[model samples]
Target: MSIMRRFSFNHATAKFWDQREAVEACARTGSGIGLWREPVQEMGLEASAKLVKDAGVQVTSLCRAGFFTDPTQAAIDDNRKAIDEAAELGAPTLVLVSGGIPEGGTIDSAREGVKEALSVLAPYAGERGVTLSIEPLHPMFASDRCVVTTINEALDLAAPFPAGQVGVVVDTYHIWWDPQVWQGIARAGREGRIASFQFADWVTPLPAGVLTGRGQLGDGCVDFKRYLAEVDATGFTGPIEVELFNDALWARPGAEVFEETRAAFARVLE
Candidate 1:
């Protein structure tokens, strides 16, 4: 198959896009899609599942379900729900943004909480045929958005679980700056723990919050060709999901953004 055929558009890349429209675009293009929780809930899980099933679009992964920094029973319950949703949608992976340090808690404590959380959720996810993909966000977001800040860290956190139950997400935007990224990817692949592979470029002059500043593919300095080569060397032939959280992109229409992003993905890979 062509490289473009491996493209999967992540819904959060176009944050406000209607869920049905995003799935339809994937269907029409014979691409895969990654969905988020809010929109799935809004559309109703069964209806959303049926929609994708009828359209013949692959649900690559589900957006998120792992803010267990505080490690409450409620948090574990929610993660179980997320696993169920992924199974219903035919998504093999559920991307997890393990939340940052809780108020009054140290970062060390937060990391432990993630471990505890994973221990609780991994078995449930395995039973549902879903892999909980631990996403290590950029170090800049370590204090608030996500404490897991490197592919290595994510892999370590996933170590105690079966690869089929827990794995790591290799998002370029998050790990491109890591000097040992290639090593991390190889390790993840060697251990059979690569669950999701996402793309987004790194741009400077980050926004005030730094959350919506992800650069479009090829618009920034990420060496995607090198990334692809390294990842492909590891035998990962799955969907390469493009996920850009750019304020400028979100301001435009979803259809336009989808086309532009898809074109960008093709250009970068080519």
Candidate 2:
């Protein structure tokens, strides 16, 4: 099969585009989609589910539902809702970004809070046929975006739970800098913890700020083929979502950006 057969487009790549239009494009190419919560909620869960189902588009994963550094009841409730939404959409994985350091708390304390939150949601997710995917952001995002910033850290957090109940997301943009990433990938594969695999290149920002400058493939320093080889070696054959967040891409028409992204992905895999 073509490597593009497993390609998935993340909605955040075109944050302002219409979800229906995006779904139509994915369906035409047999591509999958990584959906975010706000858009899904805006379109209404049932309507979004119906749209994808009717289009024969696969919902690869949900964008996120984890911000429980404090493990507040509110956070738990919201995540429960997200799990239900994933189930409703036929998304097997619910990506999670453990919230950053809480007020007056150290990174260590913040992580403990994530543990507490997971304890509450893991079983709930498992029962609903959803996997909570722990996505560790880069260390630069530690203070405000996510405290979990490494594959080892994400894997460690998932260890106590059943692999099916909780797993790690191997996102290139986040874990590419880890010296032991290969070993981490192998370990995650051995333990059945790689629930989601995503791609984005690291590039110097063009005044679009760091977070919004996830480079288009081949524009920056990521070696897509190597990442692909390592992941394939791990026996992971899931959708490889191209989740770029470039301000330039987002400014273009959704269909134009969609085609460009697909071509870029095809080039990288070639």
Clashing pairs in 1: none
Give the Cα lDDT of each candidate: 0.93, 0.93
Q: Measured by TM-score, how close is model 1 to the native structure?
A: 0.98
* Per-residue lDDT over 1-270 for candidate 1, one digit per residue giving the tens place of the 0 to 100 score: 688889999998889999999999999999999999899999999999999999999999998899899999999999899999999999999999999889999999999999999998999899999999999999988988799999999999999999999999999999999999999999999999989999999877776747888999998889999999999999999999999888899999999999999999989988
lDDT of 2 at 146: 100
Worst 10 residues of 1 by lDDT: 202-211
TM-score against native, each model: 0.98, 0.98
Model 2 lDDT, residue 17, Cα: 97
Scored by lDDT, model 2 comes in at: 0.93
